[model samples]
Target: MLLLIAFEAAKSGLWPAISSALFGQRWGDNVVKGSVSALKNGPLCVLLNFPNLALPLMFVGIAAMRRLLGGPLAWAVGLMTAMYFLFAVRYSVSDQFMFFVPFYAMAAILAGLGFVRLSEAGKRRWLGVAAIILLAATPVTYSLLPSITQRFNIAVPGRTDLAYRDSPRYWLVPWKNNEDSAGMFARTAMEQVPPGSIVILDSTTFYAVDMIRRLEFSDKDVRLVILGKDSKMDAIPVGTPNVYLDSAGEGYHEKWMDEFATYDRPAGKALFLVVWKGR
Candidate 1:
C-alpha cells in the first residue's frame, strides 16, 4: 500500500514533495543518514522490512499456527492473530503508523494461517488458486486506486528530523538506537561534504547510511551537525567548510564553524567531523 501510494504520488508529480514530507528533506531534514542502517539493525528495521517478506511469511505463519498455537487450527489462528497485534505495537511506535506496510504484513500472516489449516485437498487447492488470483489482481487494483489527491502531510513538523536528533520516541526505544542514528548523521555529513569543511544534512539518510561506507569519509575535513530538538541559533550549513539544515528558517546567519565544533552534545557531536580535504 505504501508503494501503491508512492507510485500514485509520483505518477501525479507530487512524489518529490511527498517524499520530502515523508522522509526526504522535510521530515527527514532532521536526520543525517538514510536510515539504511537503522532499517538494518533494530526492531524499527524489522518492521520496515516486514512488508517485503510478507508473502512467504504467510505460509510460515499458518504452519506455525497449526504446529505451535495449540492443538487445533482454530486455536492457532486465535493465538497468532492476537499475539501479532500485541507485538505490532512495537512496530507501530517505530514506524509511527505513517505508512501501511506493517498492517499489510500482519494481514498476510493471518491469511497464511488460514490457508494452512484447510485440510481438504480441494480446499488447499482452492487456496492456491486464490493466492494466484489475488497476486494477479494486485496490479489491477493498484492501477484502479485513486490518484494522489494530497501530498504527504507532516503531523508534527518539529519531529520531522531523523530519530537520532530528537529521539522524540526515545521514551519507547528499547535501548540506545540513537547512537547508531547519530553516527549515521555524521556519516552523511562525511559523504556530500567536501574535504576540510563542514557538512550539514537536510534528510534522514544522513544518519542511515552503511557503516562500511563510513570509511569512505576518510578525508578528515568533513564536519556535520544535526539540528537539536530546538534551534537555539538562526544558522545554516552551506558553502565550503560550512553545511546547513534549515528548512524551518531562512536568510542565514553566519557563525564561526570552529566555535561550534568543540561543543559537547550527548546525542552526538554538535558539529561536523571537522577534518577532511574537500575536492
Candidate 2:
C-alpha cells in the first residue's frame, strides 16, 4: 500500500518531498548509493554488533521449535527468520535495525523454548548450555554496559570497544539523526523573510525547513516552494519577495541562480537561506 502511494506520488511529482519527509535526505539524496551499495556494509556491521547474536540464536531456536512447537508457529518463525536475513544482508545501515525488530522478537520466543529444552536436559548439560549463552552475550553486555551505567548515573570506566567507535557502520548514520541547534536554520530562515514572504528552497533543504516551520515555528504566512524538476522559481511572479534556502554551489536552477545574490554559508553546512527582493 505504501509502495503504491509512493508510486502514485512519483507520478504526480510529490515523491521527492514525500521521501524527504519519510526517510530524510540520507536515503533520498543517495538513491544511487542505496541501490548500488545494497549488499555492501550492512552484513559486516550486523556481525560486529551485538544484535548478530540473535541470528545464530534464532537458528538454534528455530531448530528447537521444529520439534516443540506446532507446524504453524514453526512456519511463521521460519518465514520471519528468512525475511530478517534477507533484510540484514541487503542493506547495511544502522536504522535497518528497525526491520530486525519483529525477527528478534520471534527469535526470542525460539530462544526461550530452546532454553527450556536445555533445562530439561541433565544438570551439567544445562549448565554448559547456559555458559555458552552467556558467552554469546558477553560482547553485547560489554558494549551496553557503559551506556547502561551512564543512564543510571553510575560511574564506570569507559569501554573502548563500543560499536560506534569500533565499526565502519558509524559513518552510515543518517543525516537527520545527528544533533542540531533545534530548528535554528528554519527559525533563521523564517526570521529573514517578511511575515508574508514566499520561501523558495532547493529540494535538499526544502522539506526540512518547511517541516520546522510547520511543527516548531508555526509560521502560517510563509509559503514554501520546493525547487526540483517539477517545481521552479518561474512559477513565482518575477518581482515577488522570496528567500532561497539551500547550501551554496548546489547548482540550483539557472533562473533563480543567476538572479539571487549568493549567500555562501560555511563549507559543509546544510542550509543557506538567501533573501531575495527580485530578479
The prediction achieving the highest TM-score against the true structure is 2
C-alpha lDDT of all candidate models, in order: 0.42, 0.53
Compose the digit string of candidate 2's lDDT tens values, residues 1-279: 236446757776686645543344555333324443445544533443434344555556677787778888778677756655554444434355554554556666766666656556655475566567876776665556446555786532112222123222222232334434335556666655667765666654567678888886684677777666434556664444444444445355435645655553434343444545344
TM-score of 1: 0.35
Q: Estimate TM-scores for all models.
A: 0.35, 0.49
Which candidate comes out best when scored by lDDT?
Answer: 2
Model 2 quality (TM-score): 0.49
- In candidate 1, what are the lDDT values of residues 49-167, reduced to their tens digit? 33233445455555566464566754745554544343333321235334434445555765556556553334666567766776666545433322211123212212433434533
Candidate 2, backbone clash total: 1
Model 1, residue 123: distance off in Å is 4.3
